[model samples]
Target: MKKKKMISVLLTAVMAAGVLSACSTGQSSTQNGDNAPNTSAGGVTTIEFWAAPNPTQQAFWQTMAKDYEAVNSKVKVNVSAMKESPTSEAGIQAAIAAKSAPTMSENINRGFAAQLSDSKALVPLDTLDGFQDIVKSRSMTNTIEPWRFADSHQYVLPIYSNAMLFGWRLDTLKELGYSEPPKTYSEILELTKKLKAKYGDKKFLWAKADLADPTAWKRWFDFYMLYDAASNGNKFIEGDKFTGVDKAGLDVLTFVDSLRKENGLLARQVTDPFENGVGTFVDVGPWTFTTWAEKYPELKYNVNYTLTMPPVPDDVDPADSKTFADTKGLVIYASATKEQQAAAVDFIKWVYSDAKNDAAWFEQTMLPPARDDLTSNEAFTSILDQHPELKPYAENVPNAIPPMDNAKYNDLQTIIGEQAFNKVVKGGITPDAGWANMKKAIESALK
Candidate 1:
């Protein structure tokens, strides 16, 4: 998909709900009897669930619901597929406002989850019995830590997690007389210079730089990835302060500016550098590997890789590199009755608690499982054996940092990408000037 399409889709789903109301006081009569939790004549408690619109995902949930119903005959799952759009969350929020929210939501954006948590609209997963131990046994602490907010409450049960990494064509790098990809920003510049010298300036390293489009706010991935490395994993919000626009932020912007002006490494538009063979190296996620395996098998064989963790300055320790982490999972709405909430938790626990089921999810979705122990599961290990390059990405799980959880996350991303990154690269503004504009934009949005 185009960066515009992808960003627009992802953030549109996340922020479409607007601000959730803090007052969950008066119940709305607009909630139809069928929409609310209902007990059948046979005494089965029927609770509704909203599943992602993807056919495979919907099928998976339906199958799970059937299996769960067979096991717990007293609970009936009413699964409904969501509309496929960035504004899917708006529909869910509308249901919630009408006091008809689903007992459980199958897919939730991290930022939106944070908003729900802040508004007290989500049930605390930590309160569930043995939930802590299950999380510890199934997933890495770093991977799970992102869901735990300052209140020490985990609002969502993460199903899978992902991070950004550097992908390259080993053949191209070897032809350039380098055995390995660049490990640092300085090394990247040096390699870019060599590539330009060999193939002309038009054939520079291609990195996405489409900041003007709303959907392309993901362009800020470059900035956050680099800043994480330079800052040694310090978060933008430490306690209650905005620590993003700091020295590390300046360093990242300056480096990006240099990449654009000095090394000719940055692409000013959204282009597939790898498939087109325009870029010898690019930053991407594990999903790209799955895409290559399916559509471009030849390119998949030729590609070498590096996780973009520890993006440190030339003078800093390479071990300190960190990368942005994205986790997707389910959250229960607080509107669910005690019986409905317990049933929802039971379904989640049953699904993830089993090693085989977790591994099966990985096999089907090609997404890494949330639980740590499943890494050794036969199904998951077989996938790694088929594509060993994925091992490095799996190793990056420990270094993965969740995206900023602020309610204004989407707006902040747009500000950074448009006001700061776009200006420095395309408008000829200094990094300092760009940062000042970005800071103002973020502060205004946060308020």
Candidate 2:
């Protein structure tokens, strides 16, 4: 009953050709060893694990694999970075088609996991033994609640949840007679007026090309963050149903339209605008701290800038504001054998059973571990103390919402930018018209 055809259509002709060329050249990330889900001699269950094509991530997984194998002699995990011919997703699709897919892989986001689940490419992680144990041991009960797919099964075990926040130029806000960043739309508009009066059009509220790009993933930083706050974390889409709140969505569009009218937005591409003081505000992630510490050390947190959740509507409570969660997780492939699946779950359980491992993950990756008690737990106190910039992320872990679990998320998110957000920012459409148009287009596409 599996629909492998669905996955086959995911990659375009150009990407598929690249995958084929890479495979022929022995450039594929999957090793030449037997990866067909087989148990080796001595009843050892060998599982291949594809880590994200990142050096830090690959190094972490390789170390973990060696440590895990030392404790559990019956299971062997070969960790390798996934090939990114053009993208890691394409490489995974090629592996599945060639029957060389790893037993499990990390770097699986909720939206992409929905696609994999629809094609029956992933095992329902909730059905696996030790699933609840992992949740309890990792202290991620609340954090993992939103990861359930539409099918009522958990497909991905979330590793990190980057609670996206907005960073404001603290010096700029002080210059505008404010002590902290604005947390509501009305407050932001007032700040915008003061900003324009001071800097004219030379500076913008936000200077980012992604605002006008209409790229699917770009919506995560701009649209989803604000929409989540305005909607009070309402679901935009649920199981092929358009569940977006009309009032909340329109409020977000209207907020953007007002900023555009005030010349507060600069949709053109600008490098390091926030750091260079060309943009007063921009979406901030925990991953950005390391770069800032090295390259733009002058942009100190709470000194030169400060982070806050996305601005909410005037009527919404700013204290309860929510934002998009930039998260990814681990998923076991359905093609794996029963032995391999069991072993994979066992490895995950062992990895998460100790809070020290989570602390190590946080220290090494700088990505906040997906735990509800990140700020409260003593294990993470040292890391947060060392990296104070990440404290806001740890505190707001529960306030971040994961992306919609829809197989058509790519099309759905693109529609949000193309029909509504981009149009409102460009003055091509009224907020009301943009909202109506986007809703119609997205609902039509959902069907």
Candidate 3:
């Protein structure tokens, strides 16, 4: 409770401070006129693009900007790393409050984009010209459908989606007389019993400290992953409504509770539990392979480990399971001029029209491109051949569910952990009580 309250107070303070700064600087709450229409005297429309503050992402955008400028002389793209004062989101918020936000940025998630859109700070991408062309050309219609906001507007152009998966120690499963990892709750429970009967306290199905942490983002890898799979990608929140499936949420909590009963969960602070083989199963993302290559080279894909979507409920089809998407995308600020907006969209369309660009992105950054044909596209075949572990993520891009498009997603997700998931994991509450309390709290929060 203190942690949540403290974070709320800090965010409030930051926003308030931004308002004060704007007022002191003689700036209005609205965008300054000088920030728009940054066109050169030569009739070239200039758009500022703030890339995510990372070396690889910055390099990718910088290269793309140079390449784009070489072909199209009418548009100028200036790429720079987004400022991260404490955090990138906070920096963006501060910039918006001061009315100096970039023309477009590439690190926006659906939830934060919702907050921006609610304040009318974002331009709806779907309403822009040539938006459908980009969708058709990139072959991302199905993959981009879930990104639509409650207002039926597409505010973001998703670049990469890291479909969350579970990595199981295949060697350990083999030692337990299993060739593959379990895919359903009952199957996992049965495996848990055998694991306990053999290794006792030395092994666990999952050993992650974040399970008991009430941090908002922690829910993505644990609760949301399982809940999405169990519910088959149900949108837990649509706009301001708490639309989480009751049965799926309860089943997820109950599954965690079941695992706890079998001594299959360890929500304690254990360093590198998955890599060290202390935990047989843990949430995996495409980004992990980079670290594995440098540190745990022995963790070969399909050799000693395998990746699959989060396990589903007993009755749900494991083959059709869905998981949460760790995704971020580009969004144009409404503060930009119409010309700049058009130019930004044109740049996006040009960048995505070619599959080789996406292939380069996948190769430079480990993140999977948000396209439906990634697995079948000849452009990506060689890349997938080099990194077989990424094939599942590519195949499941359409199956991955993005985060809720709610401005209060942080608070809502925290309630899930504090009222339901964390409590159940710690054996402090029954699944029924946890579900009811969580639903009530989330509904109240939504109101």
Candidate 4:
């Protein structure tokens, strides 16, 4: 991690005024600032930004805003903390409907961004100056493709990303006479069976399942991880239409069902497998490593843990093993004034253009950088070196698939979870029946 620098005189003055105001009022509105517009003094354009509620993220936005204000005195940034939840979408939508939306927002996922774009509420990033070049220089085409709508308009600027990866307890593997982790789904199945036989009463694998309320949503996380690997980057939707389940999807469902039945993998909810040493094998994101290090410092540099990209089915190409990349970025509102939009773009560009700021962001968030260049940055690489468990994330980024930009994703997920997943996993229905019901549900939802 890099050392913090002293704040500029101008920023210090502004922060001092805010501190005094809070002291006199016994509280500060800056803490929430949601939907509340700030008045810009001295004819400066105030760009309202609703930021995610993460403390580090909020601090990052405020620091960037003050830095931008110091350089460009004509623009002032008013950042508000937005909670990351379904309610956030409603709040943003309400603001947009009232024509009082913020100039930009953080933590806008592809699904919500697409919804906003469909309603003509987003300013396409491609229409902004220097944005395309940043995409070409910093991000890969595959990473950006998921955010492009049917009209070829990109509505979000991705900043950070995370992907699912396979994790195994190395000490457990060695005790079981294995030198390496499974390479494919078939291998995992075979390994799980052996482990089950050896430890009949204990759980051998931490597979995804929801026996109590088995729904398509319960299986979605694992399904997409394998689906991306099987389909090799094909999205579930194309041109505002649902491309219903294919052979790849069925294969994944079958695999998941089989794991629960034969592998002694618990279908019930449990605590964090990696943290509590609950399972020999688990699938997780980058944050798992950070959490483990922070809670169990004794295991910080222990080589008893191994992390690798999720394995594909035996029939699928090994090189095609992929996982879903959860991308969060900034999005500008169509309701924003032209000047405010320009300022929003400038602020994002300034933050990403400098490697130091980008590196600091990764260090603070523990999320992988969206930019390709940042992978080679010493600041970023140094952190990876210290926490070797996070190395798999950077290695898997090249094959990571972004989520589909479908507004109906949430609805489709509920249908699949209830109609398809729960039925197949616990309702004594055949996989084919579940698949057919899922297809019908998706079709109905799309209409």
Better of 1 and 3 by TM-score: 3
Q: Root-mean-square deviation of each candidate, in angstroms?
A: 3.6, 5.3, 3.5, 9.3
Off by over 4 Å in 1: 1-23, 26-43, 209-216, 238-240, 293-295, 302-310, 373-379
Among the numbered candidates, top TM-score falls to 3
| Candidate 3 C-alpha lDDT tens digits along 1-447 | 001122221247768566445534433223365544445548998888999987888999999999999999999999999987767777887887667777899988888888777767788999999999999999999999999999999999999998889999999999999989888899999999999999999999999999899988889889999999999899999999988899999899999999999999999999899999899999888888888999999889999999998999989989889999999999998777787889999999999989999999999988899999999999999999999999999999999999899989889999999999999999999999999999999999989
Off by over 4 Å in 2: 1-9, 13-38
Q: Per-residue lDDT of 1-447 in model 1, one digit per residue for the tens? A: 113244322224333343244215423222335443444437767677888766666777787888888888988888888754446666666566556667787777666676666656788888976576667656556677756766668777777666566676677678789877777778877877788888774566655545334333465356677777778777765323467737887887787787777656655564666656766666776667667667766775434533345346787788767776655778887867666777777777676666677666666666666655444556567777776766666666666666666655666677777788767766467889888888877776766
Alpha-carbon RMSD, candidate 3: 3.5
Candidates' C-alpha lDDT: 0.66, 0.85, 0.88, 0.67
Off by more than 4 A, model 3 = 1-10, 13-40
What tens-digit string does per-residue lDDT give for candidate 4 at 280-356? 76666776656566776655333677777667778887766877776678898766666677877877777766777
On lDDT, the leading prediction is: 3
Q: Model 2: how far is 8 from its true place, Å?
A: 13
Winner by TM-score between candidate 2 and candidate 1 = 2
